[model samples]
Target chain A: MSIQIEELCKRYGDKVLFEHLNLRVEKPAVLWAPSGWGKTTLLRILMGLEQPDGGRVTGVGRVGAVFQENRLCRALNAVQNVALVTPDGKGDPEAIRRDFGLLGMQGAALALPTARLSGGQKRRTALLRALWAEADTLLLDEPFTGLDPAAMQQAAALLRQRCAGRSALLATHDRAAIQALGWPVLVLAGQNGPESGGK
Target chain B: MKPVWVQRAAAVLFWLAVWQCAAMAVGQEVFLVSPVAALRALVQLLPTADFWGRVWFSSGRILLGFGLGAGCSVLLAAASAKIRWVDILLSPLMQLVKATPVASFIILALVWVRGRSLSILISFLMVLPVLYGAVRTGIQSTDPQLLEMARVFRLPRMRRLRAIWLPAVLPAFHQGCSVALGICWKSGVAAEVIGLPDGSIGDALYRAKITLSTGDLFAWTFVIICVSALFEKLFLWILDRAVKRVTGEEAAR
Candidate 1:
């Protein structure tokens, strides 16, 4: 029902990203980390995209993730992109369309190729894809990068609303989002944790 | 930088005039035939049943070969991309095929099989390398980040293939097919000309050559070009739809 990371060790050549870093997650948690400090790498490792040399991960069921980059299928429309990962292949297009509307996407934007959408809109689509997929655990890597403050707040609120009663790990340095999320922070080591100063 | 159609038309007219001039200068039908003479000969050939049989014989086998070659190359490319050893294994053989002359293959094919299968084998041989190279590059060029996303999301194999791999592979494959289609026809027809398979266009071309029927030779050349162009257009149209269907994109006309 939850994720367990046990003595995870990852290294890139001479640099050690994580050495014996361990954590247990039973609820939504914010992974507070600065830029280029292996936040994405950590998320990747959790999602089974990478292998830790010295340790093992266990108890992560089906995972849904918003990757650091908007990894949407450019050929498909926003509705199709979300629908592609839905349970039983019965994803509700109308619901997805409605979600896009709330994220400031309207008119021809929803049906247009994801490649044609603005960066912020694409980010929202990736977020919606993760949030909508049938997964017990979610790994979101900087899911709110391109949005303005108001949009970011709205997205953060939506994430909190939908992510209830699920294990979700969000990686970001945004304090306002952190405050809005109101989730316990897991401060990563080295330059991994966010550089904090302003509110 | 003129419109392609206008430039094409100008080039065609210039060639036609030169052809007419050359035929007149030669003053004999044995060495050179005018474009008008060739067209007239084509008109005569069109009404005959033998012409259609020859067309069908050559085109059918050649196209069948191309289809088989395209299919096998894609499968090989996909397999090779996933398994590095397969690529290493295929590299030397594919290079040898590419470097060897078509004439050599045709002559060597005679030793292994009957003449009728020559065009098919030749077309298959000619098409494999082109498709393999293009599809391999396409597979290699697929966005790594998206692949990571697919892996994390635990997207099903079919879904990942339709959404990610196909879209990445198709554009380059399409381009390669464009070049390969022409090569297939040329090599196929050449094999037929050498092998002289019964009831094939190459036999007809050979007969025309032996009799010194310059006009018939010219007419057959025209027919070959038309067939090649038409096949390319039709094949590419189907290919475009297939790519669009897999990518979940809007189909083009």
Candidate 2:
């Protein structure tokens, strides 16, 4: 399934963000934009968190997202955080634990509250949670911000593996991350047309 | 360690000296009973079975009322925070409860409730508005961004409560409970004294007052203060532990 955003327009007071914007997202697509281009706002609108002044979003189903902030429950462990979004309550917590280990989390660190985790660890946990949740659509905003290069590569691979057959709309500034995932890119520049790039 | 103990002993001796001087200046035991006489009276009362029964009876009822008030406050705060209608509905009642005096509540309650239950009802009433306001403000102060994240993820209500609401509400709730517990004990005891239930500490204190046994009155008053402090410490200790367990933050202590 694909998400079709048609004539999407959003504004804040006197500032016009985007007017008569159109985008089509098929399975496993990446939405790329520079800072301050309203990518997060657009994603939020699609998720029904923000209602656009004018827009129609179709083909969104049970969205899971890594918000710009690492919104992990400060009190819960990583496994419990992921389990919170899973409908069947059958999210493989052991696998999520292993993924956290692979992402350089270890020892009591994983068991510790997310509040105690370092910035990178919390970000990785949030990303993992979004990917692991049972959702047909995943919206990730800067899913690899605090990760080192190697960890970012691992995270990209993890995202690719977990998001198979699911539509993904990833917003990121890192060109290298965009290339590493090899996702078809939709670039927004200056509220004009979206520039398409390498798949 | 020795110096610390010596300092504490010196402090107690200093207070005793001051109290003895005050008692001597008064030239009457009725006005201000000496600490020595009060201690002697406490020792005499300690041997009686009725003392324990009085202590337990008052303590149990007041603690029960405090617990009920605290629990209901949490539930009501949650409901009020989630629904504007509930919040509007409860605002006037909370305001009225806060505005009313403890004595007034005790007097009004005497008409509707039996004398035995007066302390419990008064304590519950005294504590409820405090806990409700604290928990409500705590819930209101939660980060909007985190709630948005939870909404997007569609987290289960119980998980959201455990992970989000509980952590946000705990510190304020703990503070409220600490304050409310002290007030509950004070109001409870005052209500009991007014009502004069059969086997309660308040009844004993009332009897001491009637007989003008200044020593016994002072001793009973001291015991009440000690019990109230002890209850506050124990309840807050348990509450801190529960908050830490829920938020998974050991530093909550």
* Predicted model with the maximum lDDT: 1
At residue B186, candidate 2 shows an lDDT of 91
Best by DockQ: 1
lDDT of 2 by residue, A1-199 (tens): 7788998899899887887788888877788777778999999998889998886888987888999899887777777777667775447777778878777776788787787788888898899788777787999988999999998988998888887787889998898898888888887875744766543
Predicted candidate 1 versus true structure: per-residue lDDT over B34-63, tens digit per residue? 888999999999999999999999999999
Global lDDT of model 2: 0.86
Question: Per-prediction count of colliding residue pairs?
Answer: 0, 0
- Pairs that clash in candidate 1: none
For residues A49-162, write the lDDT of model 1, one tens digit per residue.
Answer: 888777777778889899888989888888888898897554988888888777777779888999899999899989999988989899998888988888898888888888
Compared with the true structure, model 2 gives a TM-score of 0.91
Specify the CAPRI tier of model 1: medium
DockQ of 2: 0.61
**What tens-digit string does per-residue lDDT give for candidate 2 at B1-253?**
5789899999989999999999989989988999999999999999899999999999999999999999999999989988999999999999999999999999999999998999999999999999999999889878788889878877788767767888888888888988998999899999999999999989999999999999999999989999999999898898888877766656342
Worst 10 residues of 2 chain B by lDDT: B244-253
lDDT assessment of candidate 1: 0.87
